[model samples]
Target: MKNELNRNYSEVTEFILLGFRTSPEVQIPLFLLFLLIYMVIVAGNISMLVVIKTDSRLHTPMYFFLRNLSYLDLCYSTVIAPKTLATFLSRGKQISYNGCATQFFFFALFIGTEGFLLAVMAYDRFSAIRSPFLYTVCMSQKACVRLVIGSYICGCINSMIQTGFTFSLRFCGENRLDHFFCDVPALIKISCVDTFVNEIILFILSALIIITTTAVILVSYAYILSTVLKIPSTCGRNKTFSTCSSHITVVSLFYGTVFFMYAQPGAISSPEKSKIIAVFYTLIIPMLNPLIYSLRNREVKNAVKRILFRKKSFH
Candidate 1:
C-alpha cells in the first residue's frame, strides 16, 4: 500500500529554500550583513588555527582540542554560509536533491563530531584540574590523536546512517523548505510517506549524541567544581575557573540551541522558531567561538601579541 503511494507520488529533484523572506528593501542589507559575518568567520577561525600551530605554549591537550574546534567551526560555517549568501543575492534559491543530501551529510557529520569533541575537551579539563601531575600522562599525545580521530569516525557513521535514511524517503509534497539549509526536520516534514521510522531514528541518534555528551560534560564539570573548591587559595580557584569558563560558555550556547531544535517532540515544534534557533548555532555560534576563546584567555592574547611583534621586527 505504501509502495503504491510512493510510486504514484512524483519524486522531488530540487528544493526551493524560502530563507528568511523579507521586504525587498531589507534584502541587500541582509546580504551585506551576512557577507560581513562569513568574512569574519573565515578570518577568525583561520587566524586562531595559525596562532595555535605557531605558538609552542599552546601545544597542550586543551589547545589541541581548541584547534580542532576552530577547524570544525570553519568547516561548519562553510557548509551553510556560502549557500545562504548565494540565496540572499540570487532570485531563485534552488538546490538539487543530491546537493541537498550532500549538504546535510557534512552538516550532520560536523555537528556530531563537535558534540563528542566537546565531551573530550571536558574530560581534558577534568584531567588538568583533578590530576594536574598526571594530566600529561592521562591525555597523552597518542591519546589525544585517538580521541579526535574517534570523534570524526563517530560523526561519519552517524551521518551516513541518518542521511541514508532521510534521502531514502520519497519527497512528494511541495518542494519548498521553510528553513535556509537542508535540515533533517524540514526534510522529514516534506516526505510523502509516514516518517515514523525516520523520526524514531533521528530521535534515538540525537538523544544518544546530545544526552551522552551533555552527561559527560556535566560529570566532568562536577568533579572539576569539587576540585576547584578544595583549593585553599582564592587566586588558584579564580585561575582554574578562568580556564574552563570559555569552554563552558561555548558548550552552553551550542547545546542550548541544538537541543531546542532537534530534541523536541514533533507536535510542539514550530518551524519559525526552529529557523531562528538554527541561525544561532549555524551562524552566530561559529562567529563567536574564536572571540570567546581569544578574549577570555590571557594566553591567546599574549600569543597574538608575540606573533604581531615578531612580524613588526622582521619588517
Candidate 2:
C-alpha cells in the first residue's frame, strides 16, 4: 500500500497555476512590467555574450566563466519568466502535469550549474591573486573547460533527482499550485500522500549544494584577502578588490533569495513571500547581472566602449 501511494495515479492532467491573487486592476500593468524585464534580461545577456566573443583582449578564463554565467542566467530565466508572463495574461493559467515537471527540471539544472560556476569563478580569482607566477598553469584553458563540464554534470544529476522525486508522488487531490511557477515546495503542497521523504530529500539536497558552494566562495575569498593584504601598494589592493566586488554583488543577490526560497523555514509558511523572492532572482537578477558586470568590470566596460567607438567611426 505504501509503495502504491508513492506511485499514486494522477487524476489531474493539468494544474491551474494560481499565479498571484492580484486584483484585475493590477494584472495588466504587472504583466507589462514583467514583459519589459524579460526583454531586458534577454537583450542584456545576449549583449554580454556578443561582447565576450568579439573582444580578443577579453579572452581569458575569467571572461570564459563569465560567458557561461550569462548563458546560464539567460536560460533559467527563459524557463520561468515566459511561462510566468503567459500565466498573468492567462485566465486559466493551466499547465499540463508533464509541463510542470519539465519546467522544474530545466530550472534546477541551469540554476544548480550557476551556483557551482560562481564558486569556480571565486576560485579562479583566488588562483590569480595567490599565485600570480603560476596563474596561467593553475587555471589553464583546459582546466576551466573541465570545471564547467563538471558543473553541468553535477547540475544534471541534481535535476534528475529532484524532478524524479517531486513528480513521482501521486498528485491525486488539489491541482492548484499557489505559486507562479512549478517549484518543489509549491508542488509538494498539493500532494495527496505524505511528503516526509520528499521534504527530507529537498532539505538535504538544498543544504548540501548551498553549504558546499558557499564554503568554496568563503575559502577562496579568505585566501584572496590574505594575498591582497600582502600587496605593498594600496592601489594594487584596491584594483584586486575591485575585480572581486562585482562577483560579490552578483552572488549576494542570487544566493540571498535562493537561501530564503529553499533553506529558510519562513519561505514555506508564506506563499506570497516565496513568489516575491522568485521574482527577484528569476527576473531581476538576470536583468541586473550584465549591468552589474559592465558597470563594475573595467575590462567589460572598455570592451563595450571599443565596440561602440568602432561603430561610430565606421559611420
lDDT of each: 0.90, 0.91
Q: Which residue pairs clash in candidate 1?
A: none
Position 32, candidate 2: lDDT: 95
lDDT value, residue 234 of candidate 1: 100
Worst 10 residues of 2 by lDDT: 1-10
Clashes of 2: 0
| TM values, all candidates | 0.96, 0.96
lDDT of 2 by residue, 1-315 (tens): 233463456577889999989898899999999999999999999999999999999899999999999999999999999899998888899999999999999999999999999999999998898888999999999999999999999999999999999999778757899999999888887888788898888888888999999999999999888888998999999999999999999999988988988886667668999999999988899999999999999999999999999999999
